[model samples]
Target: MTVIAFLGAIGPLVFIHELGHYFAGRLFGIKSDVFSIGFGREITGWTDRRGTRWKIAWLPLGGYVKFAGDMNAVGEPDAAWLALPAADRARTFQAKPLWQRAIVVAAGPVVNLALAVLILAGFAYGYGVDRTPAIVDSVIAGGPGAAAGLRQGDRILSIDGRSIDSFSELARFAQIRPAEQVAVTINRGGHRFVRPLTIGVERQRDRFGNEYRIGRIGIASGSPVLAPVGLLEAPIAGVRMTGGIIRGTFDTLGQVISGRRSIEELGGPIRIAKISGEQLSLGWAAFVWLVAMLSINLGFINLLPVPMLDGGHLFFYAIEAVRRRPLEPRVQEWAFRGGLAAVLALMLVVTFNDLGAVGLWQRLAGLIG
Candidate 1:
């Protein structure tokens, strides 16, 4: 079951991710030679009338598309591809308009996000949702919650005197009320604590020089019972879920970047398998959350400006857009090799860490005895 689920999760997620790039490339009128859902020798395949060979490969760990003049099966341009005639190279990726190339590069992550949103919506509609009522899990140390006189285990009764029956409402109040002082009412123990507190919101900068806003209440809470809202309500919940997951992901990334967290905390495939296994035991709701969380991670990771990644491709596109020409093919190839090496090293490290997290090394230790 664990193996099945781990395979299932990665297979579909990867397919959808790559499909985004493939479809978007075609949408912009780029030609493709192959659109495979997995790697290695073909298990089953069909040639479209247009000569695109679609296949399900044996090694299903990941999949990719072969664009016209793709230097590699993964759709990257190669040196030999550069030797092709200019007319032949027109169908090549490097020949595409800068904007079209960027869209093709960006679409994979975008599709992952879209799949997550839809998954969330469907999950919410099927199983209902859990929301936290205006509840204080704990007061932040000198943070807004603490400054507002919130107490330990206090259920946030209201914020700014607005009646909030749900934590969603309280959270909305928190996000939009950035840097504003508000009266917070909480039930601590058997007593109520009310304090006027000035709340502070955190700010983050993005790749495009855009900024994002977030509430800075340093605490956690139990999810309230979200009785099944109507079908219409689930989509809203899903959208909110997507946004919240993205926000939390960015916060964690920021922490990692700012040295507030250790890189050792990062996990790779082993961690994902363990998590998927655990979620399988917990049932579908847990499974869906795992999918959404991983989907976000997939989206974010692909958007990273690494040379062999979607983000890396986009970075080149950005450079090309500025320079009015693509990087020299040799330069791009060398950059890709360096990036691939870095990626492999990172993978080994994360896999080791993940194995440690799951006590696999320890288990093997016991086996050695």
Candidate 2:
């Protein structure tokens, strides 16, 4: 059941991502030769009326749409496409205007982002929002909050001039800025005052034994309040939530790059599968939320300005627009080769980390002994 749930979570996302490319190509009159829901040998497939071959392959990990003028899934132009008669060449992807080509290539990630927003909006409308006001119920004795003169029942107004709506917001803000002094505002008996306090740093470990550091101020709040969301307001809330996730991701990446966070926190496909299975056990809503989060991640990763990615294609297009010519085919090919190698190396490292996280390495060592 866990395996099935994992596949179920990933398969639809891959399909949706590929469909974006397929539909956008069709819209721009660019011909596609194949639309596949996986890599490797085909298991079952059929040719559509538009002469495109649609298939399901053995590997259910990812999918792609092969445009007619492309050498492979990476969108390299080929000899066959070049040799096509002038009449048919007009329908090939490479023959389209640069803007059209860019749009078609970019549609995949855009669709993923849109899907995430819609899914999150739907959930918001159905389940409402959970919130806890930024009120201090108690301050830990001898902790930073106590040292900073914080008292019970004081309502937190803002942190570092950023308005705080909930206790979680304050904690999240503090957790990312350990050991730094921040200006905080509080409301006490119809009066407001600002206090500069240093956040206490603490090391934490997850269930998988991945460790990281977070800032704490030794404050606690009451139970969260549930607020009902209206029909029109749901999507607005969804957009806010999605934006927060994206910001948090970039911040974590920045921290890892700056040596403040460990790279061991990064996880690959195995980690995704484990998370999918765990989310499934929680219930359908949780599983769907996981899908939405994954969709956002997929969209954001593809938008990175690295060769062999959608953003890379758009990056080249930008150069073409400015120079009035495309880069040499050989140059593009070499760039893509380097990009592919980098992507594969990162994948291997993350997979190794995932194995260690799951105790697979220890089990193997025990068996060898």
Best by lDDT: 2
What lDDT does candidate 2 reach at residue 255? Answer: 82
> Tens-digit lDDT track for model 2 on 248-365?
7787789888987677878988888888887887789989999999999988888887888888889989999999999888989998998899889988989998898778999999
List the candidates' TM-scores in order.
Answer: 0.73, 0.89
Q: For each candidate in the order shown, give its overall lDDT on alpha carbons.
A: 0.77, 0.87
Candidate 2 has an lDDT of 0.87
Lowest summed lDDT over 10 consecutive residues: which window, candidate 1? 206-215
Task: Name model 2 segments beyond 4 Å from true.
Answer: 153-163, 174-215, 367-369
Which regions of candidate 1 deviate over 4 angstroms? 40-44, 79-88, 126-149, 152-236, 364-369
**C-alpha lDDT (0 to 100) for residue 218 of candidate 2:** 88
